[model samples]
Target: MTEVLLEAQSLKKHFPVTAGFILARTVSSIKAVDGVSFIIRQGETLSLVGESGCGKTTTAKMILLLEDPTMGSILFRGKDLQRLTPAEMKEYRASVQAVFQDPWSSLNPRLRVGSIIGEPLVVNRALPSKAIQEQVRELLLQVGLRPDHDDLYPHEFSGGQRQRIAIARALSLKPALIVLDEPVSALDVSIRAQIMNLLKDLQHQYGLGYLLIAHNLATVRYMSHRVAVMYLGKIVETAQTKQLFSHPQHPYTRALISAALRSRPDTQDEEIVLPGEVPSPLDPPPGCSFHPRCSNALPLCSKTTPVPREQERGHWVACHLAETLTVATRATISAEERP
Candidate 1:
């Protein structure tokens, strides 16, 4: 079995909504990330997929320790992060890194590529200036950029190259885990594949674990070892990539897959158009938060919270009717149309 690099157990983060500007009182709380849990194993890519504002990024933030969780715990190799000393926390910081959605904003415009990539080393004061430069050059080369291009500023490079530079910086720390927050979404479709391939190659070479937050199903399908689908600040489904793609048990998961398949002109699968807007996190609907948008929602779904069940081997679903839905869905689909 693969070693677990990082684990988030029932992690929760709630942002207070203040009514008044000065001497404000707490009106309500936005449940940004409510009880999300998962683990990333060595060299594995675990993807968190959901619609915008579904708390995927919030979950990543908690994992990176950028925002303190309102409740629950984060463990790095079975060691609780909250218990770490200052020095140990600093070390932990070095062990985990992140690459954000926009490379243009993430990379420093004024700095040369080499300066940007080597900044981590410079800040940590881990290596001499000459060694840092050498390391930057090697990292650039590893990410498929020419080592000599390090002198160029962010503006001089194309979007794809800028993203590669960002990636190189994240790699500079030799991190065990990387939280990639929509890393390839801002790039051109053509460049997205290249970046995805590079990430996979890097993971294989370094035995790095990745917590990928992405909306692109094709990219998720190609990159992820395991996948967790989120709905209204909660994880609704989780399974191995093959299992989830082949047989999604939750209504939301099936809908997402249907939509993804519809995007391909080649596939003729009927699109599952979910009705109703996502409920506000500040005032989420009772019971299953996704009940308002769920097609197979039962009366009980609205009154009782569903527990995640292992409906199949390693495939978990949080829904009142997952088993019934799975059986009905399978009975309707011909083997030829299944993706």
Candidate 2:
């Protein structure tokens, strides 16, 4: 197996809810990320997928160390994140970079593309201005942009072009892992494939690990080596890209797959629509948080929480009816098309 680049073990982040403004006392906690675990290895992409308020972004935040976990820990290259010293923390930041969802907002509009791309190198390494500009030019070329484009401002570039600039900025640090929080979700449909293909090619070239947070299952299927289905702040299922889509075991996972496949004209399976909105994190349902929305929830599902069971090779499910769940008859999604 490839070396593990980052590992999250039973990670949980709960934000305290305040009741009063006058010396606010903690009323309750919103379980934003409750008991989520996964590993990202070198040269692999692991995507976390779910609907809004499902804790996908929160999980990413915990992994990125933007929010400290209340219950669990994050280990990067075998070093505990929460325990990292000042020097170690700086190293960690350099080793792991991020590309946000909105490239336009991420980039500084006042700065030129060259300065934006080279900012990290200047900040971290304090490289000479001439060297930084040369490196920036090379990065621009790597991302399918003309070197001369660096002279222009952020407003001059199109959405896709701005995203390329954002990507180049992320690449400046030469990080081992990149947290791509909906990297292409903001781009046009025609440009998504280009960005996805660029990301894949970059990973192949550099053996970079990606922790992708995206709601678009098609993008997840195409860019990810493995997929972890999350629901209501917990992971419901995790499996290889092909296996998860074709043989989803958990009801929530199945529903998510069904919804994703609904858009494909060739998909024979109907969308497994769940009833009701996702439960609030402040007061989630007992046992399985997804039980209230699960269409095929068993009586036991509402009474007892299920532990993650390894159903097959590397495939895991946390559901009451996992053993009885059958493989999907629908065709496997093909992700061979690339620019």
Candidate 3:
């Protein structure tokens, strides 16, 4: 079995909602990530996909130790994160790094590329200044940037180049896992492919695990070994990448897959347009959060939440009627595609 690099067990993050400006009291709480769980293995990629405000970024933050979970535990290499000592914390920080959506915002404007990439090394590891410079040069080469470009500032590089610089910084520490939060969404369509290829190459070269938070199913399909679908701060489905794309059991997953593949000429599955807007996370609807937008919703869906159950080997779905609904959906699509 592959070694699990990181795991979250029923993780939850709830921000307190205050009522007044001065002497405010807790009125309610915004459940950003509620009871989410998954694992990332050594050298494998597990992606989290969902619509905006569905707690993807929040989950990433919690995993990175930027935010503390309100309930449950986060285990990094079998050690609970909240219990880490100061020295262990430093080691943990070096083990996990992140690349954000906007490369320009993440990089320092005033610093040269070499300095930017060397910051992690300077902080985390003790080395001579000369050694850091040599390491920076090698990192630039690894990320496909010219070693000579190290002298250039952030403004001197294009968006994709800046992203490469950011990637170089993340790699400086030789982290075991990297949290990629919308890494390619900000780049152009042409540049996106290059960045994706660079990431794939880096993963292969370094044997790094990735926890990718993305809205683009296409990108997820290309990069992920496993995929987790989040809806209203809860995971609705999870499976191997091919299995989830080919046989999504949740209604929201089906809708999103339909939306993503609708433009492709080879698509045979009929489009699933969901009704109603996503319920506010501040005050989500009762029972299953996706019930409001689900077409095949049952009375049970509105009154009782469903837990994730494995309908097939390693394929989990949270819908109450996953088996029947998925079977019906496949039958309808098959009939529609018949000559």
- The candidate 2 region of ten consecutive residues with least summed lDDT is 327-336
Q: Model 2 RMSD to the real structure?
A: 4.8
Whole-model lDDT, candidate 3? 0.93
- lDDT tens per residue, model 3, 120-237: 9999889999999999999999999899988999999899999999999999999999999999999999999999999999999888999999999999999999999999899999
Error of 2 at 88 (Å): 2.2
Taking the candidates one at a time, how many backbone clashes does each contain?
Answer: 0, 0, 0
- The C-alpha lDDT values of all candidates are 0.91, 0.88, 0.93
Candidate 2: tens digits of C-alpha lDDT, residues 82-164? 78899888888898889999987999989989899988898888778999999999999999999999899999989999998
| Model 1 lDDT on a 0 to 1 scale | 0.91
Residue pairs with backbone atoms closer than 3 Å in model 3 (clashes): none
Off by over 4 Å in 1: 261-266, 333-339
Q: Pick the candidate with the highest lDDT.
A: 3
Clashes of 2: 0
Ranking by TM-score: 3, 1, 2
RMSD of each: 2.2, 4.8, 1.6
